[model samples]
Target: MKVMRLPGLAFILLLQGCNISAPAPGPDFPTSEMADIVFYNGTVITMNEDYPEGQAIAIKGKKILGVGTSLQALATANRTTQLIDLKGKTIMPGIVDAHTHVFNDRDRFGLDLPGAQELLFKNGITSLGNLFCTEEFVAEMRAFEPLLKVKTSLFLTKTFPCGEIQDSWYHGYPATRTPGEVLRINGIKITADGGTCGGMAVSEEFIPGTTGLGDLWHTQDEINAMVLEADKAGYQVAIHAIGDRAIEQAQNAIAYALDGRPNVLRHRIEHNSAIRPDLIPRYSEFGIIPVIFGWKKICDFYPRSPFYEAADFPYRTLIDYDPDLPVAWHGDDPYRGPVNPFIELHSMVTRTEVSETGALCTPPSWLAAQTIPVQTALKLMTLNAAYSLFRDDETGSLQTGKYADLIVLSANPLTIDPQDIHGIEVQLTMANGEIVYRLPASGL
Candidate 1:
């Protein structure tokens, strides 16, 4: 029940990143000569440049002991070790969702932390960014930390219903400073514009008939100060900007805060739903991460207006503009889409809607041109998302010395037909060497 709660254990592990030289096993690391788990006889997608694909992986305690051939992995296992034959299944790093509102409105969703864990884990999500947190929410997370199996990075809300920056809430939170903690505060979330219900700030009218340009919650000067203050205080800022005007304003503020240079802070423009072609380059120019919605294209959550002009949910344009651009995907769960990454992935790859109710919405013809390859969509959901949370080096990939966060799938996403991707199911989910969720044997 008490998982990896050793004194200074987490702090020592925090010292590691993407370039793991060697395993720094703790004094009480469960086993000294034998691995706790050895998964072999399966296709392993390490996602590491060193070992792009492997046949097996070994885990000692919470750290990945080694990643290589099936023989190499089995060498570390003993009779006592839990040696799992994957039976030709596919295993890869657990899906990391960079942005979601999983914890919000739990009552309406009939969910709690345990329920949230089951929901996320079943979908192969081991890590997430829970935006729009309040002090009360943070407190609830801390109290429920023991029950949390999914890693959470929170972005505290600066105002009521995601508006009006509040300086008082920015200070006095220490445990939230790191990335891989059960619950950590990565930064503050500010709603620069509205979404879904139509307050998105835009230069052109979205609703045709009315003179609706949408709403801008804060002026340029106001957002600039808010971002700069959070940046100086050493917090990543995630702003919810749904429209072109709001996107531009967020870019401008980020540019000013970072002195017009590429930023390492990873300040994000969440739900970059509607953007102009001209604003595409600013993501790479300012190093601002575009946290886009993958399923937005398929859903009629927002009307497909005539004034769209290749401006709504332009993920492909933003991604192809710069090879190094860090474009991440979000589901905005329990709000617009489900937490299932495949639903999002299906939308990104097919440019078609996979609704929660099993109904399909006809996508705009322009959406087809915006579809990305399966590989690109996976990165957006995993590594790129981890990078956005400043946790790429720590947990994104299944590299040696990193936490053993991985999942087993019924089928491989890489080899399957694009149309059949959404059908792939997560057979097993593991986080930090712990098997968090698993389906019945017959389910596979």
Candidate 2:
């Protein structure tokens, strides 16, 4: 009404005051009511007896929602779903390296070799039990978990750089009452000695006195205290004890801490190289898991270097005591080893050297008995390794409700000759329902 000749902006503001807000769109529904991804026409080795081999699988979010015949899975298929036609490839639970040092090396040198990760992935290792990791390295691994698609356990150390002592041969230093106290922290790694180096002629180079290195690393009292602290805090301890002396010390430490405890805590002894035949029974008695590095045949013992020792009984005695004692194989790579579990598995079953000359020299009959069956060896890398780390319930098998951690392989290891196991290539690796490594078309 010509009252004040309202400006255009003023009139629009007045009109806005009378407008009503429209109701929010109904909960922004998923674009399509179907699985985000599906794999079909594949031999899905679910690792579950009920559906061991399936024609297809469906995943939603980070879990395997469905596994069955391809026709059964097609009901949930949609145009938006990323369908993977496997063309009869073999699918198995992602391999787990029960004993590895990915984070440990990365922490020490900030080095990540493509060859190492590729070897592991190509051989189907999705999870690694990292022995000898510092808290700093553990933290870095936690940060990189999503990217690496590798799960890890902390192996606390009680040596220097982070602790005190070099090779555990010194004797005169004043013993702190709280010695090894810091080792109670998560991801602590402790070593009894410098592995086989203590037994070699070069033992003096690493540790001045070969015999005392074991005692000097940590006293019985010191190890017990650290183990008790770790036990109370719900942490598993992994000890690097390759020699018999170190193994005995580790066994004693575990028994001391676990006394009168109802829960059988998981404890691991890294390498278990040159284990005393008598001490084999002590592993099960103390409930200690031995994470053996199978690649040692090619990586160390066969090299015939200063550290080479032909007498080292990798697992014969231990297997005699308890075949089901839960052992896992590892490839301690980037330090004279390859990350391929298949190579290690082959070595375990065949006990043949990777080098042609060594393999030729070894008796063909003996090589056959050394390695475990294909299925059992697979368990060592998956279920047994998970059991060693106390993470079996979460992973270690391709079961519903478990994390969708698995790998697609070119062929079934069980169907092929154990010697030809290395030929099987990992086509795809998935962790948490997400593809992490996809094989290139060239198959390199």
Candidate 3:
């Protein structure tokens, strides 16, 4: 199997942003046209504003031919078409785990990407972006590509593409001049600050008065040089900045990179937990994406450092800025957290930890100011993530001519009570128009 590069197809699709205009197909039910697969009798949430809601989807090979009414999809089918009755199930684009970590020890971690992919199918994840990895992981991903059921992209740890530099002031960019690591290496990741929850998330504000601004890995000048060199060498950059002040440093580096050059492939800020409300506008002005993580686990009602006075994960600010601000959400798990994306999504929408018995696990009014609507949260799970990777056109939503990567859920997250959203089960998951995982028919 060939080693695919990072975000090979999805990056091209990101250029379209949130706009694509197309007229609806003429009213027709069961026209007898040929299709490889036709899913009907289901609620199709395309996530695309042009066609916000759909009834069915028709697929020919890996790509989707059309998304419309159940009768319309059925009409496009023929004798060879694999007609699947969803039985009023809710179908939406597969969840995209935008930020993730597979291993703590990058040198040696015999993790199973194939098995991980299967389990993700059960969770309705058909696309994943591995924000932390090494060259070894790249080779392993290529070896496992034959067994993978989901589309993926990976970013090499800072050390993978370039090792430590001699001069403490000079940034050591990757040796590759043309960014040979395009598909295999999504970008180079660097830590501008530390953690947010009492950890080392470098910031100007200290905890009350103790003066613990966490730690800064590199000076702003050093970061600027590093990003500039990488941009010239042709690799995108992702900087980990949890604190508001740290986010500023990351933004400066991205701005330096874009000086006189175009930002075609998106540069990102990782784990932007304490996003300064003022910097929120810069995200749109600078064309920078945010790969959000840990919001589901900690931001709900946890003890964040008292140094920060604003909303912790200002997702609402990002969404309100552009509605398509390249803000992608993730768990950053298997490295620092759990692998449950839905659990994260649940926490994201509800902003509270609910127990298995459907009880609230935390205080009710802890972080209400940061709560966003379910509609915006769904984009965080799908299209925004795809846009972050520049793959929105290929797989994020149920758009005409897009990949048929979708999932069927037991309940719709939109209409159901927000408290019950996490409990919704994934009845089926499909990638590239092929059924990758399906619940037992009896259970369905």
Candidate 4:
């Protein structure tokens, strides 16, 4: 080889000519943003419209960092990051049971508050709406808020047992809409009528066996005044209405509160078990949320109910009328045993009783027509329910910047037969980026 070495300056000039330069004393390579925990190798049903499905998700502090594939999520993992291999299992946003009287479980059934919360976590519920809160209950929850894992939204009641007006216990607690809080007082609750006691306030006569039309706990004017007062005080109002007459009254009261215009307060009609077709459109027109019982069609109360002739639990009718209407679900725990969302999902999907023998307790044809799909049932339990609580932006779905409230399942509910959905187990549950519940190490 010929001895032809160029000088440093000449070499630099040559490199420049080749479109190359000393990687200009570049800035230091930054550290990769790491996740506190990364769940990979599993199906992820992110209810988020932008990222509807994924195979993995990454969590930072208390919120989701990202949701995509295993490689994408794992890219953010460091040595200290807890990498959970789902191993063909499934992950989705945690269940948000919009309504349940679990405090009644504590007082009436002797289930301690912590135990009730554990039960809720085990069932994959990350958030819940405790529909009936008295002053005593509010104080208990305030004391327990620090230790709370499942997010709580309490609706203070003006009446006990859903009837008989008492002092304004709700006046003690302010309506709270702060996102990511463990506990919040969402609104006030009232009963327009009674369902199980043959006082559901029906326009028509009850079935031949029952004596007369159902009873209304409060007259239309009285309910309107109460709802208006609550609305004025910046609190959403939840009214229990089961018969056509009660449903109509509830719609009217909500309309009166909103001055016949739609608003975002999401005032709700709890139960809404029986509604005439004429009243269904009002729910959408007035921005009224129908928090109907998910398993009512198959429950003991539905088949033997006195209210007839009215469209009972007309879920399909309501949804078909307004696809965008927010229809949430409630179990009304303690009154309904097993208080499990999966059972409710199964019932809503199949419109049948939760029978132990697997024999179908077929509902009436009209009731069967109300059956919704599994996806809609899930949304009713999670996102739509969150909307009812005004928490949809905070924790309903697995979206970036939202609380890391999610659950792991043994199987995919979407892939399984609808009848078998209730059997799906919550292998693990994460609330606010912390593991609140997990299956035993032995896989029991």
Task: Give the TM-score of each candidate.
Answer: 0.88, 0.74, 0.82, 0.88
- The digit string of per-residue lDDT tens for model 4 on 70-123 reads 655655666588877776688989999888877545766567888888888888
> How much is the lDDT of residue 167 in candidate 3?
30
List clashing residue pairs in candidate 2.
155-188, 156-188, 156-189, 156-190, 157-188, 157-189, 157-190, 158-190, 348-371, 349-371
- Please give the RMSD of candidate 3 to the true structure: 9.3
Looking at candidate 3, the ten consecutive residues that score lowest on lDDT are 1-10
Question: What are the RMSDs of all candidates, in order?
Answer: 7.9, 14.4, 9.3, 9.6
Local distance difference test values of all predictions, in order? 0.78, 0.60, 0.68, 0.78
Candidate 3 lDDT by residue in tens digits, 1-444: 111321232233235341112245422223333568887666888898877887778888887878886545655665577777676679899888776654323223354555566666777887777766655566677677666667676666663222232232112323222211213345667767766333545445444556567766677888898777667666677787877777888898898789845577688888887776678888878888888862344433335554344546767667777875768887676654445566676777877765444456653353565677888888888998877766776778887677889998888888989878767888888888888888996243
Enumerate clash totals for all models, in the order shown: 2, 10, 12, 0
Any idea what lDDT model 3 has?
0.68
Error of 3 at 52 (Å): 1.0
The lDDT, on a scale of 0 to 1, for candidate 4 is: 0.78
Off by over 4 Å in 4: 1-32, 196-198, 209-211, 297-310, 356-359, 441-444
Residue 239: error of model 1 in Å?
0.5
In candidate 4, the residue pairs with backbone N, CA or C atoms under 3 Å apart (3 or more residues apart, or in different chains) clash, namely none
- Candidate 3 total steric clashes: 12
lDDT of 4 at 102: 75
Runs off by more than 4 Å, candidate 2: 1-34, 49-51, 106-123, 142-148, 160-187, 200-216, 298-311, 314-317, 356-368, 442-444
Regions of candidate 3 where Cα sits further than 4 Å from its true position? 1-33, 103-111, 159-184, 196-198, 204-206, 209-211, 260-262, 298-307, 335-337, 355-359, 363-366, 441-444
Cα deviation at 282, candidate 1, in Å, is 0.6
* lDDT, candidate 2, 255-318, per-residue tens: 8888855436676777776665567788877668888866544423222223213225446546
